[model samples]
Target: PDFSHRLAEYAAALSTRLVDLRRTLAEQRPDTYLPDLATSLNNQSVRLAALGQTEQALQAITEAVDLYRTLAEQRPDTYLPDLATSLNNQ
Candidate 1:
C-alpha cells in the first residue's frame, strides 16, 4: 500500500467532515461542536496543504479561521491566539 497516498485520502475525508460540521453550525445550533470542528478542520487543512491540495486546504483553513474569529470576538484572550495562528498559516 502507498502510505502517503492513503494518508492524503484520509486527510481529504477529514476535510469533508469538517465542512459538514461547519454546515451544522450554520443551522443556528452553536454549541461545543463548533470549536472542536474548527480545530479538526484546521489540522486537516495543514495536512492537505502539505499534500499539495492547496485549494481545499485554504478553503478549510478559511472556514476554521472564520469560526475561530467569531469565537474570539466573544472571548478575545482565549481564542485570539488561535485565530492569529490560522491567519498566519494562510
Candidate 2:
C-alpha cells in the first residue's frame, strides 16, 4: 500500500512535468512530445482514479483521449492502440 501511494504521487508529479514540457515543446515539436504528454496524462488519470480523485481522473483521461485521437489520426498503426488503451482506462 505504501508503494502504491508513492507511485501514485510520482505519477501525479510526472503528469505535471509533462504538462509543462508540452507547453515548452508542443508548438515546435508536437510529434516528439505530444505522445509522451498523452501517456503521462493517461497514467495520471489511472493514479488519480486509484486515489479516488474522480473528477481529476476524468479530466486527465479526457485530455489524454483527445491527444491520443490526434496522434492516432496521424499514425494509426502506432497510436490507435494507445488511444484504445486510454479509452479503456477512461
Best by lDDT: 2
Pairs of colliding residues, candidate 2 = none
Question: Residues 15-65, candidate 2, lDDT per residue (tens digit)?
Answer: 777776774787678878889888888888887787788998999999999
- Predicted candidate 1 versus true structure: per-residue lDDT over 1-90, tens digit per residue: 499888878877876786677768755667656777777778878888877889988988998899899999988998899999888887
Task: Single out the weakest 10-residue window by summed lDDT for candidate 1.
Answer: 25-34
For residue 63, model 2's alpha carbon misses the true position, in angstroms, by 0.7
Stretches of candidate 2 exceeding 4 Å from the true structure: 1-7
In candidate 1, the residue pairs with backbone N, CA or C atoms under 3 Å apart (3 or more residues apart, or in different chains) clash, namely none
On a 0 to 100 scale, what is the lDDT of residue 66 in model 1? Answer: 94
Task: Report residue 89 deviation for candidate 1 (angstroms).
Answer: 1.5
**TM of each candidate vs. truth:** 0.76, 0.80
